[model samples]
Target chain A: MKIGIHGLTSCYGCQLSMAVVKRILDVSEKFDIKYFYMLSSAGKIEHVDVAFVEGSVSTDEDEKELRMIRENADVLVAIGSCAIHGGVQSILFSEGIGYEEAFKTVYGDKKMDYNGRIAQPLDKFVKVDYRLPGCPPEEEEIMYYLATFAIGSWPEEKDYPVCAECRRAGNPCILIEKGEPCLGPVTVAGCDARCIKYGIPCIGCRGPVSDVSWFDSLAMSFRDRGMDKEYVKKRMAIFASRYEGLNEMIDKIYGD
Target chain B: MRYLKLGSRNIDEFLGRISNYGDLYAPQKISEKFYDYRKVEDISQVEFNYNRTITPAKKYFIPPKHEMFEFDMETGEYTETMGDVKPFVLFGLHACSIVALRILDGVYLNEYPDKYYAARRKAGIIIGISCLPDEYCFCNLRRTDFVDIGFDLFLHELPDGYLIRVGSERGHEIVDENMDIFEEVSNDDIENFKKFEKKRHEMFKYEGSFDNLRYILELTENSPLWDEESEKCLGCGNCTMTCPTCRCYDVQDLPDIDGKHGKRIRFWDSCQFRSHGLVAGGHNFRETKKDRFINRYVCKNAYFYPLGTSYCVGCGNCTYFCPAGIDFLKNLIKIRDVVGEVAHGEQ
Candidate 1:
């Protein structure tokens, strides 16, 4: 199968993780590498069997590139939190701030290079066949996606939260016990509760699990735990600003 | 039942000798407040007075991630991957946990027996020890506070040492093997053990009655408490995963990039997870959180109550590990209370 690993406006962390995978060489050997800018400079908009597009569509250029990849590829998988939920940069969208104001504050009227817009997930611009969500996708998930595609099968997405693995790992609940604003209860599983294992609560870098996140319920619980309503909203907006029904759900609990 | 006494000082030596038989797994302190059953490399690591482990002993029989079989796509051949399950002694189990294991035995060993669970269960030896109930524990309410037949050997702590009650032939063999460490159970020792049991019963800070819970749940099927509790539930699956009797699982085929070879694996799944009720056509039977929440109560109380078992051992792992702090016992009582109010008003 022809494979393309493309990046739009990401930190390149997802591509770096994918590149350093122990079985990347083996995976490359099995599939036809049509395009991957991280691995090579043969940057060509080419057709591929499976395309793993990372990063959010933050600029017009990114949107164009994503659309091109979608048009060429038979299957386009949105990889990492950036492509799946618009990353931390999408915080501006959820914070009720305009992209131009935030851009001006950061760039301070610098000379134009590319058309900048409020960052949005890949699905907002193009049809995403599947999504591999993480700040950087898990190595096991990366391998699973590659292997399943190789065998003409599809990898099953996790519909459960991080707490599934967290509880299984026998880690103490930081949310209830320590009163930490742990998002493990709302975030998708598959990072093996990595942050929680290290005694840190989850910041929900993997974004919400498609439809069953229960943001309103979690927000209300967070309020009961004495967290500021805005603080909870900002924390959720970090990687999941573009999460489906996230703002509405949060508003349902905290809105006047 | 045969009874013997083991001096507390000789525990390390007895554990050391048993290491030759199989791997000795005992409760070891993970953090300041948490304990888990871990492979004891050193005898000093064993914690005797732990309240409860994060997960139940069911993890030993049905691991969190179990590779069921490895299959070859080209040849259509598969091999069951039940690894070399060596004889292992699971030491320091509490009464509630022992009862929970029996509940698991009913599920995995009855009807069509799970080969993997049976293999692991056969390899394991249970050594029950008395534990003081913490604020979360409600084993007394569930009638699982004292185990007599489930464990091979049950140790009740006394002022001087431990009074060991041998339940199985294996327990007798163990006593014979470590005869030097044991002493003849005197009448004073038996008297002390009985006194210790009475004291332990009074030590439980949490108390409740779960009698007729099935009927109460049945009557309060449409109670608003379900919605109230479901709102607080994070749907994290912690309660189900930590629950000893929860046997739900999801199977997956993990293929190597070669496309010809793959392994079929089963992992612990939760009924609370939205996808648990998702059928092939994407029709979720339990679409609302209230449905899933109420289903758990019904499964634990109503579903199997007619069979003389509630399926809940009241180990308190669910309440203890819940990020949302949804207490199962409290919910049951609340549901019962709601039904009582409605019945009283009608009268």
Candidate 2:
């Protein structure tokens, strides 16, 4: 019943998306919105039923807050692409670019009192009970999960690939018909493939489906379509960049 | 078990009978060798045996730009608009596309009920037709069969008339209401149906075996050819847009010029885009094209399998539409071969 929402160095889309849900329906009667940095005044923390945390942990301030929240909350849910994975911020790790260089790029020689390392998802700091993966969580999905959690019956997590949904939606085979490089075959299904439905390939934003290794044929199926090896590696790395096994695969293909 | 012996003259009568329920959507020729599904007034206008359409049957259930909800910014109020639902008929759905639809149903309807999608889906009836296979089609390879998922109705062409199988209660209703137009199917006619099904199987052969897919991914991980293969990629994102399975999207608030009023919208996005995985502070996880490209493969082939569905359907649309002519099948073979060679110390 008591839910706390917080964000650290994120686009705030996930929190905003939850707000959109509140406006759409009278969910207040069902949920007690206790602590939210954006929606309400920052107040003394208390024990909560569930804590919805968004964004990657990019600052020491965030790490302290995240640790405290994890220790107190019964359930911790990573609410978007950023929190579920290191998100785009993890790209810095790939290039060995530190936060100092990033700050310099923006401030142009301005003296910074403090700078930290590149950011990572909250899971790197503490255990995450659940994940609603997307650039911004889908409203329908958010509502479903909330309702399920409220009833004490957790919604079964979908481990299927996006391709299953894409096919079910009756969209044309984009990879075959349009020769587009798509991540659907590998990406997880949650958004009902709104992107592929609207004439686009999946970018693997929802992270890997479940057992990424089982769908190897689907990946090779891309190659059978004449996609370059480098092109496939780069696309797969978008969401699974933090996944050591996936990165190792990329290293083997591209030679470090 | 009802058969319709429609002489060329009774085609109009057939169209008229179906339209009484609601709108009838069927394939229409847009240009030479291109067809699109649209509402048809006359049955003759429907192209029943066309290869495939530019878009799949998903448009009916999930439109290109659908409003999930409308928000009034000043009032800070939101209204949920339930998608329109009406009983209508979808004519001439192919086997490959229908299988795609079933896969989507498993995701949206089974696990988490998508009310908006379910509403629109309930409004339509699927009537499938087996058409000539296309060169790019590999539905059989994926083990998706024609007429497998129970459609409301299925049509098979014959020399004299058509054989109609009523697969659902709604389909039987249409037949029962129009008993005057149909004749009971004979035992010989059933045998003919089996023949046609067999012929279809013979026509569409699996080009390659899928058994080695997992091993292929393992071998490809360290293959050096990926570097050389990705050089020509333009990152235009066309392949993903046209794919049946690619579902990644970007959500943004589209505020008006005044920056006061805006609607939150979700649009189709591609990993191929440079900023797809970029964060607010300007860190891109998959910075290089090589990494992004490889990520796509791992997700589809490796990651998606664990999730309970294979994202790629082996449609071959990506190969056909690539402007730079990236051949997915050939590249897969090359990776397999190269990876095998390296393992054997022969490369």
Candidate 3:
């Protein structure tokens, strides 16, 4: 089947992650890598079976490319945290900041390139058939998705918190045991509890799982562990500030 | 049952002998208050004073991730093989976990029969230990603080030595092989055991009859408690997966990139997951947070209890293990303590 790996306003980390999946899974043997902007010079495509879009729409050019790719593909997958939950670039978006002030604040008077706009996830503009959420979508998840999609099925997402996988990994609860403020209970799994395994606490890069009510509970629990309430809010806002539920929790606790 | 005494000084050698069989697993101190079952090279690292490990001994038998068999797509060939199952001693199991093992055996060894889990059980020898309860433990509430028939051997820790009980033939075999490390239990050892039991009971905090909980669970279908808890419920499955009695799972194929070679694997699954209850037409029965949150309590009490087995071991793994620290017993206590008239089927 013809597959296109597209990138927009990103660090190209997702594409790099897909390259790792490509080498590990030997994806080129099964798939026709027709229009990966990073891989091939030949860009134009009439139609494709699946289009994996990375990054977020942060420009008029990005918006048009995403729409065109959506029109030319049967399946459009949001392939990373950027395309799924608006990545680190969406920090300003969370604070409701605009490009003019954002650019001026970050890089004063350096006016050059393209029409830059506030970043947003792909589903905000067009339908995303699936979302593989992570800082760079987990390598195994991308492999699992492609392997299942090859057989005309889709893999079920691991929607539980990272604490579940951490238990499976047989790691001690860093938060409860050592009194560290970890986000494993509030964040999504499928990262194999990566941060927790290495003795570092989870920063919740993949965002909170759906149907989570205990984001506030976890935040307060961290507060109970002697962390400031604002510190807990700021940590959550680092990765999951865009999620309405997390924001509601932040609002409930801080009344902002 | 036979009673013997082992000096605390000879523990490492006795355990080291058990390791000669194959592998010996003991609870290792992973963090300040946490312990986990780890393969032991030195018996000195084994500890029994911990309240709860991240997982119970059930994890050793059923496992969190298990490869059932391997398959090759080239010729439609499948190979089912019994994995390595050398005999090993699981030393320092808490009294409550011995019961948890029986609970797991009743399910996996029943009609359907999981051969993998059965193999693990056959190869594993249980050595129960004395556990002093803390504020979080409620195992006594569920009558899991002691066992009579399940373990091969049990060690009651005393000041200078351990009072040992031989429950099965395996326990006798161990004693016979290591006669140099054991001695006949004296009158003084019996007195020590009785005193230890008294102090163990005193460590428990929540002392109330659990007889009325089943009724409270059965009648409270529409309680607002479900809605109230859902407000803070992440439905993270930390409660159910850590639960010793909760044994839900899912099996799936893990094929290679070429789809030519693969293995079928089984892993731990939870009902709190969005797709766990999803059905035909993409309809999820437990769509709401309340539905998933309440179903867990129902499964523990209303569902698993009526089957004539202990469903909640009350080891307090879920209480302290959870990031939110949402205790199921607190919810159950709330449901049981309501003073008004019964409100049936409101949920």
DockQ (Cα-based) per candidate?
0.69, 0.03, 0.59
Of candidate 3 chain A, the 10-residue stretch with the lowest lDDT total is A207-216
| Interface DockQ of candidate 3 | 0.59
lDDT of 3 by residue, B168-231 (tens): 9988888898999898888888999999999999888988556456667767767787777766
Which of 2 and 3 is the better model by TM-score? 3
Off by over 4 Å in 2: A22-25, A96-108, A210-222, A229-234, A251-256, B1-5, B21-45, B51-347
Model 3: CA > 4 A from native: A22-25, A210-214, B302-309, B340-347
The per-candidate TM-score of the B chain, in the order shown, comes to: 0.95, 0.83, 0.93
Note the chain A TM-score of all models in turn: 0.97, 0.88, 0.92
Every model: iRMSD: 1.5, 12.8, 2.0
Docking class of 3: medium
Model 3: per-residue lDDT, tens digit, A111-222? 7678888777888899999877788888778887777767666767666788878888888778877778788877878888888888899888886675553677676677
lDDT leader: 1
Question: How many clashes does each candidate structure show, in the order listed?
Answer: 0, 75, 4
Which lDDT value does model 3 have at B37?
91
Query: Native contacts recovered, in order, as a fraction for each?
Result: 0.70, 0.02, 0.60
lDDT of 1 by residue, A163-226 (tens): 9898777777778677889999899999999999998989999989887888887888788789
When superposed on Cα atoms, how far off is each prediction in RMSD? 2.2, 12.5, 2.9
Ranking by DockQ: 1, 3, 2
> Number of the top candidate by TM-score?
1
